[model samples]
Target chain A: MSGATPMLELRGLRKSFGDEVVLDGIDLSVASGEVLVVLGPSGCGKSTLLRCAVGLEPLDSGEVLVDGNLISATARDASLRQRVGMVFQSYDLFPNRTVLGNVTLSPMVVQHRSRSDAEEQAHSLLDRVGLWDKRDSYPSTLSGGQRQRVAICRALAMRPEVLLLDEVTAALDPEMVREVLDVVIDLADGGLTMMIVTHEMRFAEAVADRVVMLDQGHIAETSDDPPAFFRDPATPRARAFLSTFDYRRRSGRASGSLTKE
Target chain B: MGGAEILFQGETISRLLSGLMVTIRISLVSVAISIPVGVVVGIAMSSRHLLVRAVLRAILEFVRVMPQLVLLYVVFFGSATAFGLDLSGEAASVIVFSLWGAAELGDLVRGALASIPPIQYDSAYVLGLSRMQTFVHIILPQALARLMPPTMNLVSRMVKTTSLCMLIGVVELIRVGQQIIDFNRFQYPTGALWVYLAIFVMYFLVCWPLSIASRRLERRWAA
Candidate 1:
């Protein structure tokens, strides 16, 4: 543990799926209300680390603290998970639910809020994500971009201290990626503390306060000057990663090496 | 007695209606009893534990492959001989139908549960939803939506399958139709045919809306 006591902190976090090590001795700290972005090659343990920090995976060894409170430190993940929120790549909204229903579900179910209040909060979140017009629409009825946005609203409805985004816009079409990123940028501007795993170098450069590039389950580089990192990467892996950013394909199809085919 | 009236006359109509009610009663009761059982059993079959899953899968498969008529006979006749306790024809029908419905419904539930993306589970945990919260708020809703169409289809089939209960003397619509035919054997040769056609129309009316609902729901799923 550091003397400074960051809002979100990890110390020697280690995780493995069977024999394959997803994260090995990883460590980082984000100050209160920091917008941090993590970038890495495909399957380089970025998502796994996010999962561990958010309590989705049981860490083999290490400690995770949220606002100086223990969340997942080998024995007590179930208690600490409530303070963190995460958005998925596929926008895992309850398909049976409308946009409002997706956002209101946890508050209504876990927080035991009245339906009217939950729906009211849900509607405000939908409005924030610019999907208030589509609140009654089922997730299947919405466009990919809209669904991802609704997913964001669903997470935001939890009022979490730290929000985690894992390739949220990757599932979107190229043209629609901007709309989702624009919403994220808006959130960042509002000083929402976030840890985003993203491939959108341009968006990350614009919005993120700091960027961490991981290779083989280790932080290869960390830079606050996003433009400098893009222009002159300190590490070879970071250069290889940034070079893949293509501004050409209009559909956000990820013209890079990690094209989700 | 009359030229147009047969030996049974309109007797078949009244008996058939009574029988249809009995059949519907059995199906509804059985299905109500079966839903929870099927869901739990199917989940056990799909469980991560090898021994538990093996046992559940073996039993479900054995039951599924066995003939319903045979099971009905066992429940109707075997229970009487073994326990010296006899159930009424309708009660027997309900029990047998429940067993069948549970097996089928459980399979439907299991399939629905399995179809959910693993990522959804990951999302639930990451969102800080507790275990119970995930099941109630996340797993159940998604499974219910996935299972509805198939379960509705099975219910229609179950309604139609009640005809088989006549073999056990349950006095369902088919049994009533049979009794009327026996009485009017000499009067009208094809009276049975018209009665059957009426029954077919009634079944169609009962099932058509459910079928339509299932299809619409499926289309919505794709959307």
Candidate 2:
């Protein structure tokens, strides 16, 4: 990821929700097609950072640049949204629409693609995520994992330059988590630029090109070698968070291998 | 027995039917006009400008509290006297009902719009949908589905309230019933009672389906 052009950059990004500082002076950048995994405890501003990056939440201070162009304001240019796709923790699919409709909406509505073309691409994307059969199904009918997978396809359908996943699998059942993570793993393999917020330590270790530990509204620790970072974290906060995983592993609460089918 | 024969009279029946037509016309026209007006007003209620939302909210609140009869008088007698324009009773009825329906529907729409989760808006924004596009493609479909039952309830309410137009001399259903009673007062002492009962049945026949439909919709969408 070194010396690559920064596809997404957050310079001095600051946000607050009425005295509770959520994100404070966060500066980070992702190179084109690099997968950056963000790890943190609850209320560490990980979700807020992704929300700010996509302009869902207004910034208290600072700038977000995509391809080195300013996109800092809460009211960003409409075209810029096509550059960043976001998947929410709740799977935020439009309940009224069919799975095909959910995946094809922005492409047809925003990109103004022909119905045939949008559906054609939508079919391929759904097939990629192994949800082609569920195209006619509504979000309500699909499982939590299926819904989140469809959401990922919805974001991917836009052909965004940078995809932001905010705890995408956090809402899934234990048995369902692997299916969604597999879809994400495929995307990472395809060389898509992604910044994911997750608690799946094993999956983060396996897939992330670089790992960032966000603590108290700032980047407390970052390492290019995710395995090393997991094995031996440099910061006290990172060590504490990583140790929780060890405890979970010892207690058999978490899977030791994310690749186990 | 005398009024029972009057019930079979073609003249009395036709008079009631024509009054029914007038009532239906007023209700249909008012709904058509008010729904669009309400939608516009409702969308405006969500505007970012504090003053715009505040003013619209104030007007809707005032309309909600003020009686329809009072609004009818204000638009009919008050406007006629103040502006020196001789408005027809039908025109006055349409105007007043429209204003009332718009106010009621606008509030329904505002509440429905508000009831949508904030995350939906965030999803739309991140997907690059324009505000109008978001409302049309994303927000409106879900909101409208939820709005239908209450909106149908409003339609039934409006249909029932068209009876009030008699006070403005619109000669709607209730007015014709009054005419029948007065004409038969001496010949058939029980005529008033029968006429009112008939009016009650007519209202039920027209509005019952709407109430049933609203309830069915609530059940259907609840799942």
Candidate 3:
């Protein structure tokens, strides 16, 4: 991991909202084509970490590097943004545009792709996510699952080097969650670089090349083998977090099964 | 009241109809000028910088609180007295209404911009849009959709507000109606009521459709 240059790197990242520390001084890196899944309870700053990585949130004092180059948060760097695509939990598709329009927007506007080429890429991506039929549809007309898929297509259409998904399935219905997770699994299988923030243990286990459990704005545990992490977490905090899920699963209260695919 | 009487009412009706045309022309031109200026002001108000937003808000507040008639008077008189600019009543009415319309629509646009969820901005940022691209491609399109109802409502109000231009002696529908009444006060006796009724009907015919359109837009947005 140290020999190869990281595709994405965060060094000494720190963020705060008023006096409440959301992300303490932290360092994280992801190698090329690696899937790093971040896991934590709410308020653990997993989402903030992703946000800061993409320059959506200004860091208090830190640096973010993409493929060994620093990116300025204030500068209007179209290429810098084009390299790091993100999909939100809310599926924030531009409601004013059609599905094709939403997906092709960045490619045409930022990358300066010709309309024909952008639409070509958009069509392929949409087809991959099984949303080709909904190409002309507005976001409001789609199901939760379908909209999330379109959101994924919109990000992938930019052809970024690294993709960040912040709890993409958190807003979906239980039945809808599988379709989105399946897309992530397919992306991971295709060897796309991804950093995902999610609470779905089974999906994370299936897709993550490495799993890091965040606690109180800090990395409490990291495991290269997600299965081992679930079976037996080394850190007490990781164990405690897993145990709550375990208890929930044993009592048949967990909405979805925790079995590894 | 009927088609024959309406069409054959002669010069009094003809003059009033011509005034109606002037009113329509002013209202349309005012809307065209106001909406774009209003959108600019609205976007300025939505700036992330507190200082910029505050300054624009102060100016918009002044415009909002001041009466349109007073603004007309100020622009009509002040330009002449202070700058020695002899602005015609039509030009003065345009300036005053455009200012007022821009401020009202600007506030509406500001509200629409504010109403957009923060996630939209984040999404646009991640997709690699520059600030301007985000606004043009993402923010403005969505905001414009949500802004339609309020904007149309303001346009109708601006149409009605054009009547205030009569105070400055521009020959719009209201002004022409008053002239017709004065001309016919003794000869026709009850002609004043007819002229007033015609003005009322004209204003209603112009504004009622816009109100309906505004409501329709609101319902579509809700859907």
Candidate 4:
């Protein structure tokens, strides 16, 4: 890779809640058009890392540079921060707004774009996500998968420099997870710069250009070859973490045995 | 005398209607002032600053603990002797009720805002919305829905509570009812009973619609 400024860079990021240190000093960077997937145990600060990077969580001591511009934790540069979009585990679409309104709100309100322009882009994004028909529907009316797709569309409406996905499918039903992940995988195919935190091993292996495993608030392992890393993790901690997932055995089977009618 | 006859005698119905108008004026003016002030205070109550929250909480509790009658007395009578600033009974009622309404509504606003999930704010913030934009476009709309029912309840409560103004010689609905009763005590004989009954219906007429609106909103939003 050339020595151009990394798309998203975090230097010595540290965060704590009260006395409990959730993230120790950590440094990481994602190159332009790179798809980096973060894997970790439940409390390993993977979500916090993404939150800090997006300025949702204040960092204890660190600097976040997006395209080489500093984003302070306290006084965030709104223009710089706008270039990073994030989707949460719970698809937090505005409950009061319809799907189309949710996607177009930021563009019209923050970006000061004309309503027609914003709605036009929103239409195409919703169309791309197969949700154009559900445009006028409130978030409460949609299924978990459909709401998640609208959320992805909402983030994409910003035309973010880098998008952060925080366990986007963790709240979905088993049958619904594949649909959300498929939309994300399609985004990866489109060469969007994304930093995703997920527990889905196979999806991570399929979509990640680089994989980083976090443990106890630190990066425990990094692998440029995700397939090799998934097959044979370099560290014992990563191996144990991957072992906890039953994805390999569960891949080709239905959830449970069914009795003959 | 018949109940209908007692109500019709000497422009009694007109007198009561004028008195009801006074009651509504006080309640409406108070509500109009309180809703906006209360909403602002409630937003302040939800602030992250320790001192701001504490100070607002103390004010909220003080208003909650003190009886509305006592507040009316303090503002009406106390301000006169203490501050040498005489206030009209209607003005005093307005001031007292507005303060009490704002405090109550502020607490309700605070609760409604708190009930919104933190993820809602996060989602707006990550989309590059400024704090004011997030509040106007996202938080306020959601909080307003949750706030409607309780706020309507407060309005009815204020309307009913405006009867307290009679004690300060405000000659509002209840005072007018008393005047009618005193004047017709011997002639109508049973006029006091009918007069009080009419007052009861008058209050019911004013408050019942407010409560119905509140319940309907609660059901619609809950669904």
Where model 3 places Cα greater than 4 Å from the true spot, the runs are: A72-76, A248-261, B1-7, B48-55
Give one digit per residue, the lDDT tens place, for model 1 in B1-223.
2333442466656777787888788888988998888888767766789998777677777667888888888888888999987888778878877888887887788888888889887777766667677777788778887788898898888898888888888888777767777777677776667666667776787789889999998776664
What digit string (tens of lDDT, one per residue) describes model 2 on residues B93-199? 89988988998888888888998898898888888999989989988888888889999999999998988899988999999989998888887787777777777
Candidate 3 has what TM-score? 0.90
Candidate 4 residue pairs in backbone clash: none
The order by descending lDDT is 4, 2, 3, 1
Order of all candidates by DockQ, from best down to worst? 4, 3, 2, 1
Question: How well does candidate 4 score on lDDT at residue A172?
Answer: 94
Docking class of 2: medium
Candidate 2, pairs of clashing residues = none
Docking class of 1: medium
- Candidate lDDT values, in order: 0.81, 0.90, 0.88, 0.92
Error of 4 at A122 (Å): 0.6
Candidate 2 runs further than 4 Å off: A17-20, A60-62, A67-74, A245-261, B1-3
* Candidate 3 lDDT tens digits, A1-261: 858889999899999999999889878999998999999988999999999999889889888889999987555387898899899999699999999999999999988989999999988898899999999988988999999999999999999999999999999999999999999999988989999999898888889999999999899998999889988999999998877776443665567668866
Interface RMSD per candidate:
1.9, 1.0, 1.0, 1.1
Candidate 4 DockQ vs. native: 0.72
Off by over 4 Å in 4: A2-4, A247-261, B48-51
**What are the per-residue Cα lDDT tens digits for candidate 4 across B1-223?**
5755789888999999999999999999999999999999999999999999999999889988998898889899999999998899999999999999999999999999999999999999899899899899999999999999999999998999999999887989999999998888878878887888888999999999999999999887783
Task: Tell me what fraction of the real C-alpha contacts between chains A and B each candidate also makes.
Answer: 0.73, 0.84, 0.93, 0.91
Evaluate residue A245 in candidate 1 and report its C-alpha lDDT on the 0 to 100 scale.
73
